[model samples]
Target chain A: MNSHDPVSDCPHIAQFGEAALVLDAPGAMDLGAQQRIWALDAALKEQPGIVETGLGMANLLVSFDPDLWQAEALADWLHDAWVRLPPLAIEGRVWEFPVIYGGERGPDLPFVATHAGVTLEEAARMHAARDYIIFAPSVTPGFGYLYGVDPALVLPRKKVPVMVPEPGTVSIGGVQATIGMTPGPSGWYTLGYTTRFRHPFDPHAEPPLQVAVGDRIRFVIEKVLPC
Target chain B: MDNLALSMGNALLGNPDHAAGIEVQTFPMRLTTTQPHLVAVTGAASAFLDGTPLPPCWVMRLEPGQDLVLKRPTTGARSYITVAGGIDVPLVLGSRASDLRNGLGGHEGRDLRDGDLLPVGPAPHSTGAQDFGAQPPDETLAFTSASDFLDIRVVPGPEHGVFTAAAQAAFWQDDWLVSTMADRMGMRLSGEKLTLAQPTELRSGGILPGVVQVPPSGDPLIQLRDANSAGGYPRLGVVIQADMWRAGQARPGTRIRFHRVTTAQAIAARNEQRDLVAALRRDVARYAELPGFTR
Candidate 1:
């Protein structure tokens, strides 16, 4: 496939307020659309006058200085850039994490299993079976939106988000999965916990977090240590 | 625009070796300068230099070892402090602004803490103390009070039609209170619960600072500077960039009213704000050339 083929599916680009231009892809949360969004973001970052680029699951927000570049100029630039954008090849690192599932680590295991109409053990096995891709960072720092969860495990978000106190708690909301970096309110059902995850916001640390968008993540269940 | 005006005013006052901008939240904080430098404070009116009352939105020279203490604001929630040059912090992602979430930029990528030492950039050879005072026009300041309910203008968002008729009416008609959850990330507004006609499952998409997101709970959240780049909630409208300053200045418990505006009106408002900053820059330049100006 030609890398510079204009993505075939044209995205709807709209002016967001005064300083930003949002590019909305055709499909919601589709991997192809996400990749296209990333490609657009990468291309826009190279253009002049673009102050910042923000990523959504399937959209991109390009913020520019109005004094430096006009909205119409930016929109035109985007069209040209999108046509010349290379194939989305995000060179990302693969990270392996040892997780403790069920029992004390994940109180919502039974609830998730019951919702999926599967045994608790089977649910844990199903969750750990696949390698997930980091879609994007969502809500907070260090929190990644992991994709590729088993379809059966997909659950609706909680009506009232509960404050999950434990950091590194793995949870699922709808079709998305995330690892908690901080003790905060979440609507996702907790499935496990991992100590390997690090806080993404350390001033002294270089690159902050272990994971980045498009990175592959594999969660392995830790072996029980007999006392 | 207030930030740009203060930075320009500080430049005109002569010292170019100071932080061009200072982030002053509501809480009181102190900064003990190691050297005498020219500085300007804008936005909030409550700040002092070495125990003497310092005027807001004006340039003043601080002596070496003088402590600049910013107290709780009387008018605005955030204050901008500009030194001659600008704050000296290693740029992260090409910006001097601190990203507290990612722990990047500014002084160690975090809020200014006690005993945290910061470095200042080098000043231009012509930079020195000058007795020049320039202030931005009151109309340009855009500081809103917690007592006086804020009227923020908004433009229709992409998903504005997803809201129910009653929800749409309530969004503009009902008075929304800024909840305690307000911060750099976003402001959670409390008011009449705005329910959609039907449950709408939106795909997460690009979000801007002023986008008004309606969550499942029906409360509206206005995204701010540090808000996540994207969100999944249905956005009814986005506050115009011209009036975002009002949202930023409004403290918790402040009443807010949303006024729908046309896209053309939003653009005009933004242009008007830019004009004010440009006008203020000219005024500062003219004042600096006065004969009595001295270090």
Candidate 2:
């Protein structure tokens, strides 16, 4: 059920409430660990009494019918399943997005450049240097957090989130980078704006999102606006 | 959704409990209808049709051009209005809920504005008698609460033990005041600064509705329907699913006290609520037997 070996670390599984369970993989955020989580997510959905499963960064949230299953029993089952499950290998498509860095598009570009001891051009280059992997669905539908950001480019998310960030905005928070699927509050530092991006979500579509988890995204430097 | 109020409102009108309805918040909501309609108002708010007061949870007939006003509730914060036929908003993702966060569903994906005309679905051939009355859930499925505090039942969350003993004690015992900064997303509470026994970085995980998460500021936030899918704050407790409606009806400046309950107790409470709705559906069926009301 996985593309890699079974995860060696034991997951911390606990009852969130009467009907939900939260499972946290040990150690830091790792692709291998997250892959295992994806495997678990898919497997649990097939189980009876499981209502829904939500994906998080190296974590999984499961909602179940309390009348059908108890939390203790479910937690025990999840532990056994983790040991038997392997990392899920997703054959995902690659998407390329053109982005404009700095100026009004990216208000925090200068701050990022100054903090990283690099010029604005260098900062933009560093951000667009590598491909990013779509980890999981974020706080909202369709959108997801991207991994593989350069460690030096990482910064803690804002203590308080801004009321609104423009839709299709490209941003970085901690070691993760993401693009805004909709305009909403966010604590991430805006780095650029995706240019002429296609609609990523559609409620009418059978499969709502254009991009799937485990997909790869490349941000191409379309234009760099000066601050 | 305010499940109890919404369901009860529809039930009073001989409609299925799942029918879509208008959710009025902090109301002084007024609507003038152009077509005859059967309507019911549920929750704590009172309603008036053309200056005539209707009892709480009462259903009545509204003629064309009649004015219906939902008065601001002195206690609870929200109300529900159900028509004989559901509100005919185009369903997005199998729901009529206005997803304010994503701006994707219901009434052009935004809040209802003045001059907006809401379309109603076709009603059943027979819509039961008008001027019908039923007991409100607040009176039937009531929870014990003090005059100054709303008592909400909660189940200890996964990270409940991470908080210091004093913090845990204060969480259940103290009457936390609901802050002004509250909305569909969540209600922030101000009270004792809940601290963890040892500071630890928590990976962001899925957030459930009714989860009481503690931010760095130590204030507790009870996540609601529009909350983000995930969060990193440490969760102290979750308001039991059965009591979420009570929390939903709590207005700003209201004091809330969390009552800890076991998983079994939470399930029992949920079942009790379900039984009430089921019984109400059956009880309201009698009006359908009235001559000329047969479907």
TM-score of each: 0.85, 0.91
- What is candidate 1's CA lDDT for residue B223? 91
Candidate 1 chain B weakest lDDT stretch, 10 residues? B1-10
- Model 1 scores a C-alpha lDDT of 0.74
Deviation in angstroms for B107 in model 2?
Answer: 2.1
Residue-level error in angstroms, candidate 2, position A23 = 1.2
* Per-chain TM-score of candidate 2, chain B: 0.95
Backbone atom clashes (below 3 Å) for every candidate: 6, 1
The clash number for model 2 is 1
Q: DockQ values for all predictions? A: 0.44, 0.72
Model 2 alpha-carbon drift over 4 Å, by segment:
A1-8, A102-123, A160-164, A182-185, A222-227, B125-127, B290-295
- Candidate 1 regions with alpha-carbon error over 4 angstroms: A1-14, A64-92, A141-143, A198-210, A223-227, B1-20, B27-31, B49-52, B65-69, B101-105, B108-110, B113-117, B125-131, B140-147
Q: Return the top candidate by DockQ.
A: 2
